[model samples]
Target: MTATHRTYPLDESVDAVIIGTGAGGSPLLWRLAQAGLHVVALEAGRAWSDPSADFATDEVAQSKLYWLDERLSGGDQPTAFGANNSGIGVGGSTLHYGAYVPRADPRDLRLHSLQGVAVDWPLDYADLTRYYQEVETFLGVSGPSPYPWDPARSYPLPPIALNTAAHIMRRGCDTLGIKTSPAPIAALSQPYLATGSEHRHPCVHRGYCHQGCRNGAKASMDVTYLPAAVAAGAEIRPQSFVTGIERDPQGRITAVLYDRNGITERQRCNAVFLCAGAIETPRQLLLWQAADSTLPLNDAVGRNFMAHVSTQVWATFPQPTYLYRGFPSTLITEDLMRPDDADFAGGYLIQSYGILPIMWAEQVARSRPLLGQSLVDYLMQYPHVSGLGINGETLPNADNRVTLSSEKDARGLPKPHITLTLGENEERIHLHADPTLRAILTAAGGADLWISRRTAHTIGTCRMGTHAKNSVVGPYGRSWDIPNLYIADNSVFPTSLAANPALTIMALALRTADHFLQQR
Candidate 1:
């Protein structure tokens, strides 16, 4: 098999087939292949082999990296899709993510046992700490030697240099007597070599992290695990969107079907890994369930949808904060993330925020309802304004779910219809923190505030648990109903954490892959 780009014959039965190449599937692909298993990965988006040629600094032009398919987002507080946070193409959302990588706290796992809301994770912090360290070291994460908030652990690389926005956020946090730390991010701080790949470059503070890092510094999967996986003899088939699964009378998946360039193809495989992300994983399961009622899936397949209540406050400063300047969200504070005095079930953490011009302009336009002149007036403050936001936990709600719409996509699969709404617990968390968020900006000599609300990190459509009745997958991401089917992505996350989900998602992938290796 050719290492760089291998293609398995459709009739050949591969040992394992994974269906996404982001933080989830890529890890499994690399590990499975390293174990000498015949693994194949399918990506729904473009290959993006060359960063310089495939990526553009322009926000609108870079949108080709996003999953812009038609999906109706509606609810009391509807989650917006596409460029804001949804990303596709070869590295998944890591391609456009701000590189804010933080491990989930131990308290985050025992939500139900600790706070009496939501179920506790089937796995624990101790189960993930080693894998977390492995992933951070693999990406050469930049951070304080000993992460201040999670000081038990240490980073492999130095933290990225602080920008103006970070400095300002630090000042405000200091004034409020809050503990802050250099955000542990995936972008390398120095040239670091992966185990089997060439040295990945460090961040240059190009101010386009959100628009998709044009260089290899940001640790997107294209520059990370995907290459390693391919180098290990794993086959990667890009532009292949999986539409269905074929199982024998025994209910074990035998073949995976997908659409590639208007051609429907099938790949025979012994085991199938569904890492199509939160939205699509449930959609695929639901589609399969609807097609055959005899499938052993329960209602948990598409239930317990969750997202972080991303409430942000923006303001202008006298000095140019240059919001678009350095590594985005380079500063963070977890001091207020777990306030025991609050009535809410879970808390939130704050991160300094920045984005490119066009994206920021659109945010102001919609948040302030500014048209021509009013919008231009806000744009004038672009150079001097900055933002700070909280990503708090929202309790898992079966109502906030991904279901098949009456509509179907080009491939004939029903389009996913996701509806999300913030419950009283989430609102209470925001109501308790919004004042402090605004106060921080005020303390930082900021003026002209704009507060915004949205949901981020699509999570928990295929949650894991100890029982088949309560969850779709087990703790190791193996489907409870199907012996040979597994899920390796954020979709299997039991709940949304206050921090970014990428790191933990990757950690879980490592954990699941390790379990698979052990079983073999």
Candidate 2:
């Protein structure tokens, strides 16, 4: 079914207002609404859950769901950063994400205290671990505890069955002495039970996880938190574009003012939650400060950003692997994700999964010739060819940040400008990934392998810190400058951990929601 298009007039008043509706805002909306707060969630994008039309395919042009459509961008920003990559739809970036929801390794939290690089998190893994479990229960994540490579935690559910490529990768790891494990995913490996809801069944391994889950098998925010928030009487206003936050002379947030398409509106609320992702959240704060003279913001609102530095390694197998038949990612290895003290550079998992035919073709076309008639010939002769990737952490650098570009959008707001260069520490970490990646590929019996430098996972523009002087949000995610305003998203991370960021983002939201509940 196509997404229903509707325009909702903005509400004038609400107890609390949350912005952005992806991993961060969606769960917070549910939690706050369930806590009996009169909440309103504003999403710049519309709701899209149909998998048939949105799945990764051969089409040259894609639906709005295929890419992030928010007005906030980095095209005209002062810095040379790429445009923010996230869905503008109701579920936010969760709509287009590959649902590999691995937990942030415990070592990732101690970056400052241990390695003396970035600032340390006010809270530790133990503090946020329970909330991680809470999100796992709500999302029905499937994976084994203690994926053989790193430290262990009890998964709420078991791991999904490994596909052929994963199995072969596992074999390669075994031969090479590198441990392997099932990739943690948000999709249901089998039927799972929620307290008051029916059991969600398993995925059929359709490799369409990115386009949106058709069978409701992938546990996206739309299927999990949005419904729960609506059930709890939370009002969600999609297509509502928030412009600036209103504050009184006393410095407390008075209301959230926004517009519906082109009409102006406002919502008076006791509190505000800025759940917009890294780029937009910081941009919004910067815009507010630029527009208003009275808001007391230090220089840290848009500083110290860090996006995971990632690279892909493609390999050609000797047999028919059909890597695209199952989930987008089904296996991962944490061998490289050690503490900064290890022999290797502190890195994260090596991920391998299938892509859509066209995307695969595009990749081949852009990188090398591996598709079309040559690809068909290669597949017929040696169908087991596969690909893998390395997503590693880059240390937080104040210079690597988000800024407002001089160029204006259609509405005249400055697009996000990004100036990012991998720090020396991050470059060292990437250098260590080459040999490890080669080992994994060689062990898997791949003949000729290729590697490229490109990462889609971006994070850490507005991190949480002990002191308000260096960070945008306090330990509890409340903005130090704005008493009634809080931020919950990947932006709150002090350091990008060695894992896929979705689960960690949800976990942070759950943890922040708990803090909010305690205050109530």
Note the Cα lDDT for every prediction shown: 0.85, 0.74
- Report the C-alpha lDDT of model 1 over 373-416, residue by residue, as the tens digit: 88788898898888898889988888888999999876667888
The best candidate in terms of TM-score: 1
User: CA lDDT of 164 in candidate 1?
Assistant: 82
- Candidate 2 per-residue C-alpha lDDT over 327-432 given as tens digits, one digit per residue, 9 for 90 to 100: 8778888876773555433467787666655555545555665657876664443345677777888777787677887878767788777666776776676677
The TM-score measured for candidate 2 stands at: 0.89
- Give candidate 2's whole-model lDDT: 0.74
Residue 12 miss distance in model 1 (angstroms) = 1.1
Q: Highest lDDT among the candidates is held by which one? A: 1
- The clash tally of candidate 2 reads 11
Model 1: weakest 10-residue lDDT segment is 1-10
| TM-scores for every candidate against the unseen true structure | 0.97, 0.89
